[model samples]
Target: MINHGKELFSAIVPTEQKGLKRKIYVITKAFIKL
Candidate 1:
């Protein structure tokens, strides 16, 4: 059970990180266009 929770938590962290990275990438592109 503990292992399962840890895996779930780890998986969520990466997806959240990727989401933040993608948002930053889009913002950067917009700023560059301006």
Candidate 2:
């Protein structure tokens, strides 16, 4: 359903985006520190 897909996108996409951002941040920080 179109509504279902939109709901799924709203719920899931931002969370995954934020998680990946945090991971990249940590990795880059560790790299810089070392």
Q: Using TM-score, give the best candidate's number.
A: 1
Q: Which lDDT tens digits does candidate 1 get at residues 9-32?
A: 565566675797765565565456
Candidate 2 per-residue C-alpha lDDT over 1-34 given as tens digits, one digit per residue, 9 for 90 to 100: 6775565556555556678776556556545655
Q: For each candidate, C-alpha RMSD in Å? A: 12.9, 12.4
Off by over 4 Å in 1: 20-34
For each candidate in turn, the TM-score is 0.47, 0.45
Question: What lDDT does model 2 reach?
Answer: 0.59
What global local distance difference test value does model 1 have? 0.60
